[model samples]
Target: MAAYEIKFRDARELAEALKALGADMRSLPFFDNRREIRSVYITDVDVRAANVIKQEMLSRGGDAAVHAHAVDCGVTESDVILFGTVKQISFLADKLETMPWWGFPDTVKVLREALASFSKKPATIDLPSGSSLAFGGRTLLMSIINLSDDSFHSESRTYGNVDVAVARAVEHAKDGADILDLGAESTRPGAARISESEEIGRIMPVIREIRKILPLMPISVDTTREKVAKTALEAGADIINDISGLTFEPGIARAVADHNAMLVIMHMRGTPETMGSMCIYSNLLKEINDFFDEKIRTAISSGVDRAKIILDPGVGFAKDYSQNLFLLRHLESFRIHSKPILIGASRKGSVGKATDSPDTAGRLEGTLAVSALCAWAGVDIIRVHDTKENKKAVMMAEAIRNADYA
Candidate 1:
């Protein structure tokens, strides 16, 4: 007899494994409910709520981990980490809905929303051009086209020549890039902010030329200024990738809404000039989640449709080397927002640190490693410098990820 182990990512995969064992189709759902376990973190939860949650989960054949001081009320609030199968958690949420004290009912609502969001990924993202960006089946690649003279990757800088920028865009398109991101200003450490006119001068010509060349290819402008986003969208850009997460220039969200364009809200702590000094976090993942929650609310309040928004964890912006690594590993946690997650870990300092490659040019292998991991983690869009190579990595990783489906 052979005794070993099997692994599955979600209920569908679990069902497939059971079906291969000749299990009854109707019983698959029943097995699916109890086969997989999940963990969810909720911070600053009221101690009263924590106790009730613990009791309910235990009563349902699951458990929760609370602060050491939670049981005796030594702490006013406690951080709760819940552990349970899908069936147990769903049953717990249903029971919590009947309790009217300490916002248990509201907690249940949030829990249900999160559970639903994480389980079901968005299949397609509608774009402004009456087209859609498909997801779920495979990973998408966004090629970076830098128009700054002082870009970290010196070889990629095309500040003065529009022809060079256009050529790079064409090459990226031919290299299987699903989206092209053009950034005029450098956001590297200690990089000075350029005037609006200078920024526009660098990218406007390139945007117009790219629009003329690849009329159907989606163009994204990486900027934090309202006027720049408005100009780019008017001149043929379809998405705005804001590193500041709409905090730097809230008006940029309005520009996106008015143009009916997509927005990529990235989480960052400070400006490029000061972000290096702001790499402090008590709880990295929770802080980022809170940041996304607020920025998402801000974008929606400014009239941007929820479907047109994407979330990026800002891998290199304000994160230190270790934090960047941790962020990449837990990209799936961001799925709770129910937005397509975009990762741009291409040749960043973290990649250099990981591979012991001090030079940007030598970090291709590390970048490809990160790309494969992101693809397996179900990242929707991977912004990369080497489009063709990373496309291959993403495709191969995706094949392995869905190998069970075959």
Candidate 2:
């Protein structure tokens, strides 16, 4: 007799393994729901809802973890942790929909949406250029093109050099970059802010030249100013990568919507000048999740399409050394948002600190390590400096992760 345990990351992989073994196709979905267990953390749940969740989970052969006082209605509100398989959670959601007390109905809707988001494969993002970028199959790379002399990485700076920036963009496209991101203003901590006109001057020529050279290459303009974003889009940019998460100028969201361009909303607590001092967080993951919840709602309300949005956790922005590592390690937690995730950890201070290499030349290995980590976490896009090396790292990570199960 042989005893063994089969390893699979998610329901899709489990289904694939079953199908390979010639299991009945019709039974796949049933087994899919039963194979993986999910732990969902819901906050500010009312005591009544907590009790109901506990009872419903228990009925479904699952469980809910709440404050001990929750059972006696000793607390008005408490966080709830649900432990269940997809099938069990689905059943609980259905049962909650019929309950009218204590916002149970609303909880049901959000809970089900979260479950769906967690289980969903990557989605396709439609670009205004009448093209589409698909996610989930492989990690996408966004090459860096810094148009400011003040950018943190000295090698990436091409200020006042349109030809140089365009050449780098062309090289990145050749190096397997899925997107090219051009930044005119330096957003590093304590970095000086530049005028919108100055920013436009730095980026427009490069963008126009890139459009002329690589017309099919997707361009992402990294800026927090609405005018710059609008100007870049008008001059052939396909996406606006806002590090402010739509807070610096919420109007940028509307501009993205007006142009039908894609938006990369990144999380940053304060302006670059002040962000270094604002790294405090009561609960790192929960606070970030809440921040995204609010920012996403703001973007959607400002007329941005949900499908055209991407979420970035802002690894080095408003994050301390340790917090940066924490965010990278928990990238999968952000999957509940259901939007494609973009991580820009390339050549950042954290990478320097991690590998004890303070220079960009020595940090390439650390950056590639981050690239591999992001790929393993199912990240949709990685904004990086070393395009070719990071591309290889992502490919190797994906290859190992998706190796055939025998």
Candidate 3:
């Protein structure tokens, strides 16, 4: 099965004409966005029929283009087509040479078609605030401000007095943080637990102060305790970043649901203290996928709106070095849930192992590298300790990724 992307001014009209010419109408739709318009996904049979249609469109004063390629068997069985208003079209066909003959044509066709479609309509993603999260758009940087002193990275610790914590939040906000993630308990491996009272006391004052300084900026409280979450929400936090997927604290889901707050559900193997030891997995990707599937269902059951939930693979939380890298490389897989994916690999232990940097402060370059990779993978949010560095990396990545579109 081969696919092709056809670009034209009147995508819907062209799509209708293609369907009239025996193309699959149901399979092709005009991809629309703020920038341009396009239609995509034409099969091999449709591409063959599209040649005549292309000529007819050109003769009728409608500008159109066709990109056709064969599918590859190794990576994908069927060909793909992307029809849009794209300026330049290219693909990694050489990488697909090892694919089976049955797959190569369709795979090639899909790329060509998608590239053609890109000319019609560039892809765009909308954020919760109705802002575009597309490539080249304004990148929102979420700074990691952990109130726990025992967090894995010593630099992430902000266990000072409320004044100090508030100062840190102000500094991050001043340094270009679009969102602040305030966490009370240390989610670091084998960290000592804090009482709910301690957690509330440690976080609430800081949250309240930060809100006073930056009321319009979004504030996220990273906790799994119902009481702490509710307290922070009442204190002016805008979102709940639960690493446990709301399983550790059953009432968190209900509280967040009831409050209509944005919720970030991260996938973790177990509690932080037990996570390092629970790194084993039969299929890492599938396990994470299944975990999110169930957690999403649970969130919805608890009265949370489906659109308010964001999925995080919880990189470096429980996985060993290799698994963390694998998750980062295949980060886009989580998009299957159709929700925004947030990645927090800032100054993580995995980077320590990869770059032989024992100190988190020395891992800024590595963290930026991972942030750039996440941006390339279309991750919606990147939680980082160095907001300035992450924001710069995101800007560069977005610029490079959307160079053609711009």
Clashes of each: 0, 0, 36
Q: How does each model score on TM-score? A: 0.97, 0.95, 0.69
Winner of 2 and 3 under TM-score: 2
Model 2 shows how many backbone clashes? 0
Q: What is the C-alpha RMSD of each candidate to the true structure, in Å?
A: 1.4, 1.7, 11.6
Give the alpha carbon lDDT tens digit for every residue of 345-376 in model 2.
99899999999998876889899999999998
Worst 10 residues of 1 by lDDT: 121-130
Which 10-residue window of candidate 2 scores lowest in summed lDDT? 122-131
Error of 1 at 33 (Å): 2.2
Q: CA lDDT of 81 in candidate 2?
A: 90
- How well is each residue in 147-234 modelled by candidate 1, as lDDT tens digits? 9999998878887589999999999999999999999999887899999999999989999988788888888999999999999989
Q: What is the lDDT of residue 40 in candidate 1?
A: 82
- Taking all chains together, the TM-score of candidate 3 against the true structure is 0.69
Candidate 3 lDDT over 334-355, as tens digits, reads: 6556676789888888988899
lDDT of each: 0.89, 0.89, 0.70
